[model samples]
Target: MSLSNIANDPNKRMILFGGKGGVGKTSISSATAIYLAEQGDKVLIISTDPAHSLSDAFSQDLSGGEVIQIEGVDGDLCGLEISPEKGTEEVKHMLEEEGVSDELNQSLSMLGLDDLTSDLHQNTPPGMDEAVALSQVMQIARQGDYDRIILDTAPTGHTIRLLSLPEFLDSFLGRLLKMRVKLSNTLAFFKSMVGMEAEKDRSVEIMEKLKENILQIREDLQNHTETEFVVVSIPTLMSVYESERLLVALTEQNILVRNVVINQIMPRNESCPFCSARYHSQQEVLEYARQVFSDYVQTELPYLAEEVKGVEKLRKLASMIFSDA
Candidate 1:
């Protein structure tokens, strides 16, 4: 099974593991990152889910802003959990620079806007996490520090917002930036008349950088060779249907999704009626997935006897998924 073309395609720089919540995407993404790192590729795994689980999957505290090197992995693997709250703080700090914070604050204070823009992240619209996560991807990709980037994305609905955000955010931000530039010009003119120097247009700088990142993100994500998405799901009616919706949505966005992971496939216990019935129900969904999702490569991950945590378990999981090559 071509589970994200990791072993097969050397050109794919970004791979995203996403699906319904609690579908083992974190485990899969961490395993894949381990696999690539062991293969001598510098790999970084990032968790975009606000409910970060990379720490639990690897038994480490990855909730911090800095990238943490994963212990006990076979190769060069580092992990980061990017939080929207953290991104917002970074923006606030940029706006309030060293030695400039006091003056900038006083200026805005006189303008009677300091209180409103003080905690900027609070006023950000809904789904800012998705936008922030995508921005992180663009930032990382631009840096060229890692050979491969493995993303453990949010659940289905939020992930859709992330994948489709490039174009929508690009256009929306474009218009917004235009209006802001006009306002900045007006402010600059007024400042000149008052015999005062105009404060630097920091928002324009940040927004322009964001616009550039969004455009690059869109181009890279749409290119099949540069990016791939693996949908992780379980053999159940609800999860399977949602996986189908995720697949269709990806196709519509022109993002590449060449692999489907059907996690937690259970075995039948002949003596227990409940086990047998559950297996039957799961089998039906498996077969349905085989037909509807036939266009992409499909792989089955059996239900683990224990939680797949720490390095040993993750390495084992990686063997099962990527050992096909």
Candidate 2:
């Protein structure tokens, strides 16, 4: 399960890095994206985290939610930071496209339900941000612009919601479509009785388009050969515990997870008593992780003296992770 496998596999189009924050996820994911791009694969490394660090990691600004070509790498690499506002607006715009909104409004107006339009815009779903973020990236994958996409997600909670969102959204929208269909049917019965005509089912049209957006990502998510979730955690108790819970949740959602990176392992130093003590302490946690995540490929990253901030430093980190490749 070397990352070389992901870089080489035609089906492995997406590699998602997720875990508790501050576990070196941003650095690791960024480095992996660079490594893949360096391998002659066009790569897009995007973050859906509200608090974005891609700009810092890449030493460039990726703010504004627009894709920017990364300059320092010879390999093709692009970056984007999906803000909550952008994600919400993307979903809103998707729903409103193809005259769906006009038809919806016309139907509502005909049914004497113009008030529901305001409610539709006001009502917010739980994972609207995550759902739209995923939808946007998946759309790119389906379009085949990049050979691989490295998804640097928010913390574990948000990512878990994202994995589960497709199913939840499907169910949610299915219910709304059902209600709309029933209401329209009822109206049709009355209209027939009055020798009038029933309006077309615009809700069905809208829901179908929304459902199409999730289909590709949802299928790729469950297909382990197509996508993989890499869990990153430090050699600490709390991170280990959270990683375990995250693993369970990912299992529940049927998302594929094959790699676990134990970042920031302290190196032994006999001269420094503190380093020696912490090094031994970290080994215990590492051993626990090796046993707990034995089912997955494990990579240990030694604590570095310098921050993994620049392209060269990121290259160093990537070598440590994918030296064999």
Q: Give the per-residue lDDT of model 2 (tens digit) for 3-40.
A: 56566676788899999979988999999999988889
Q: Which runs in model 1 stand beyond 4 Å of their true positions? A: 2-4, 92-123, 174-205
TM-score of each: 0.82, 0.85
Model 1 lDDT, full chain set: 0.79
lDDT over C-alpha atoms for residue 115 of model 2 = 61
Candidate 2: the clashing residue pairs are none
Best by lDDT: 2
Provide the overall lDDT of each model, using Cα atoms, as 2-decimal numbers.
0.79, 0.82
Which 10-residue window in model 1 sums to the lowest lDDT? Answer: 98-107
Best by TM-score: 2
